[model samples]
Target: MKIKYLYIGALALLSACTANDEALLPAGAVELKGITASIDNGSGASTRAVPEVKDAIGRTAFANGDKIVFTKIERTENAINPFIYSNIPYEYDGKNWNRTTTDPEKIYWTDGTSFHTFIGYCLPSAITTWEPDDKGVYPAELGAGKDEIDFSSLSEGNNEMAKEDLLLYCNKSALAASDGVTTNVSLTHALSNVRVIVNIKNFAASAIATDTQTKVIDFKLLSQPTRYTWGGGSNTLSVVKYADNNKKDIKLWCPQPDGEGTAQSKTFTFYGLTTPQNETYHGINGNNQPLQFSFTVTYPDPMNPNGSPLVKTYQGAFDKTVNFNSGQCTTLNISLNHKDEQMFLGAEYSDWSFVATPDLGELRKKSTYMTNVDETAIVTSGQVDNIDDATWLYHVGKKVYDIYGNDGESAAAAYCITSSLQMLAFAKEVKNGNTFEERFVRLDADITMQSSATAEDYQWKGIGEGSNVFNGTFLGGDRYINRLNGSPLFVKLGSNACVEQLHITAVGNVTNGTLAGTNAGVIGGCKVIDDVTLSGTPAGALVGTNTGTIHASYYTGAGNLVGTNSDGDKTGTIVGCYQASDITSFTKEFLTNFIDGTDGENPTNGLNDDLNAFYSNESNSKKFRTKFNYTFTPGSYPTLKVVTE
Candidate 1:
């Protein structure tokens, strides 16, 4: 789980520029000095740390052929915009100087004036200055939330995107020393840098280059902001890159170096990235989830190089919003985890293919148990294939129960069909009536049923009936839950089941009687299960193994949400475990309340790995808040709603 890091530092400014000694200097003119700045290599430049950062270098060191821009700052009528002046080409040769201007006097300046500098990558020849809005925010591009500086101009032909080196030193104070004038100035990065590194897990060097001929290409970043404002010649500018409606290729044919040490990975660097004044600006898509900046990777098919390319889009699980500070070099590591060839789409071409097979493919399957047939069901009978015949046992010559020949069997042992009527209807319509749809569809009915024999009325109105509930054997191993708004619920499943898009209110105990499935989803409103223990991946309030999208979902409770993988690693994700456009909401309270239990409280309580897992993991889900115009209510257990107003 690698997270982006923001590196910061200050470079001491040296005075070296001097006026032609023959001409008497202006009354208060100051001699210019040489500039000194160093890039802070986040990771040890010469050695590797546990969590390494990228290395920094001098302005002259543009590994990819980029140059630095130099200018001076002056006051302007626009309250929020800076006045850039005195553009010059100056250089520092370690200890000496080189001035590109024909007149040395032109480069020299008065003591009271301030200096401003930056890289010219994507900078328009003449910028259109405008007044700030009522909120002091300059106008943003039509689709974007803020005005972003367009670097798309740097795109180099059919297969190229924008990448340039940049630095900013604004409003640097200068004074004429009584003897010799020297100014103290520190240059910071005007744009943030994103280093996209690719890694293929469980892959050998031979397979990467020869067998799979793995070439990562067409690496584009979608939905990024495109306008910006250098904050009035200030040291730091609060900028916003308006979201682009379409995807843009920022890197073409990113290089793949032999991965070093354990996780063999390759790295590509994208420069001149702008950060937003509000780092949480995740543009809302049609489904209302925060839009994500997609990282699409394509490779040539070894069998059919001219055919459609093998593509895989990598989306981060939690932090969909880009967060970069001044002079920060952030890293985004994408790993192509190796799995069975049958699981990859291009496996037919090569045995060494690495692609995530289609699971739900942007389809969100949900049911309220209130309707026998939901026209909006994203999980159709077609998506439900590979029914396990062995589990579909015959009860008295009738295929009605599990191997044990009973109804309401512990979900751990089998896939329990919560609705008897719907099961019969679905089985009859099961493509050819071969098997029931269990692996994808969740069985959580909102029907009324007796809680216990001793009780007078039907208190529990959901999955599972009274005494004989857990007795029936389940088939086809789909995740099943018996829950009401806030009451205790029972959950059971087989290894491949994934629970998604179900809402639960109230403070109820969620008992995972069986730990068979690898994933689960908590879409809609759900209070954190009081007591939860399972071995597989436990996705929080939003989703488990989402291949499509999850939005407007949340969890609220005093209990702790806990579970870990077989290796004791907590693989609990909040949203977007396997696909893109998965949006999850978070607040200070969500982070503060849902802690792993402290005392003899919830067994899964007190765990703090959620923050890292949801935000820093490989899942493509974006984390956002109401302040960012994300339409959701706020509270101990907040709720998401349609913002009609």
Candidate 2:
């Protein structure tokens, strides 16, 4: 909420520096002024307002005694990538920047050919910064956390939070080195500001009639990956930090005005964040939902209006995407009613605007990297663990009909499975028609399914079936799933599903199923047919039927990779289908699709990203791993080796 008493004004320094090469020390001075076009107010200070941007959310002028931290990186003899001076202390004396720290290093131009980069930020009392890295990105080591400019302090009320607004700036063009040339440093917010408004209306209190007294008790956001490690300079955010706190108070963390709403409605804001480009919210907590939260409200008991008010809780979920751009203000309007329903009204850009591009980490639980996972999430079956919905996930005997049974899923989106039980738990979800969609399940270690063929032992059924399909992605990551007991490791592989680089030794098929019914098998987005079993109903190396597209994939075990089944009798009504590479038999052309490692060819073999089989290391001649964590020899029979990035 933008309160006039709180967001009256903000301080941003528009600075410029000119350098001249010195024959002696190569020293230069880089000065900063207001944001205007050198419009000196007869007092030697420029005004802070930009003429083009009117109706600003907050005033853009210094209140004197303000602090601005600047850093100068000198390029001499190609020395430090971004170094020389750190936090060149400067304080605003209402009109000019004065020194706050003693003897801060001065800017020195090396030569006309050499260059110097400048980095700066304002409102030092509310934030802090670190030295830049070799790539000119500050805090050489990033993604650690908000130690430099912690966002946690933002829990304070909007009035107090206003003082901590962060204004960041880094000169795109550096000063000519070895010379005292002037360079301008304009401080603008690198994070986007979002104002949230929640309106309460018609309630489930209808049972209590007019005597119902509805009141708000508590509120918290329910959104996935709302925050992540922040980065400066060229490096955008590449990692994630989940928003799982049940009590994270909402407050403006960036420079933006706030407004107070009525009792039925409340207002708060969040900042220090940007959305990643071309990506969607697919994390475990809140899949593709935006501006969501959990709220608690109370009303008079229906039995007696004077009785203690009955308490009720509500959850928010939306089919929305959060793609806010950098350096802008966006407002999110939400409405809650007595019916315990929520409506999200998208985003409304505020008066304070710029190129707002939200940049955050990948929220999708697609293909996971085995290491550096958020261990806590893996233990709780991810965000769904908090959802009270029995249909969200459950156990077979406990609640078998739920969308899926959860045994393990902490960071399910990207958590790696290390045991056979974990794999079984995930498969149970797939069996219950979870779909998984774009999620990724990776095996960190070899998973051994039921070892003995006994009716007493719960035989591991294939990952999916006619009613339920496995539509997510699977990355072997150089791991294996051996001794599989499922008739086929995966049944009814969904159209969008894929698997590769997983070594398996089973007594039956490796995989089977026609994509989503319309005669699908060995498709465009599917790969691999590893060690197989010889005793299946139709019996094959890979699948029982072939209908979809199969690229440059191969199988070494005895028997055809795909069984000759065209009728839909099995489960899928054999629709239009094709196999670019069928392996009932191999030929020179089949071999031709894969060039010998001697020539050094791309493993995809002219196919797109979906094709990855019979991998060969052309350069090494011997088996080697690709960035995809797969290693295999280039000959007729390729044995998988430990793969690494």
Best by lDDT: 2
Query: lDDT tens string, model 2, 319-339?
Result: 565544444556666666555
Candidate 1's residue-wise lDDT over 275-361, tens digit each?
432444554343233424444445566567778777766554334544554445455545555453211111001111111111111
TM-score for each predicted model, relative to the true structure? 0.32, 0.34
Q: What is the C-alpha RMSD of each candidate to the true structure, in Å?
A: 22.2, 22.4
**Please, what's the RMSD in Å of model 1?**
22.2
Q: Which consecutive 10 residues in model 1 have the weakest lDDT in total?
A: 347-356
TM-score of structure candidate 1: 0.32
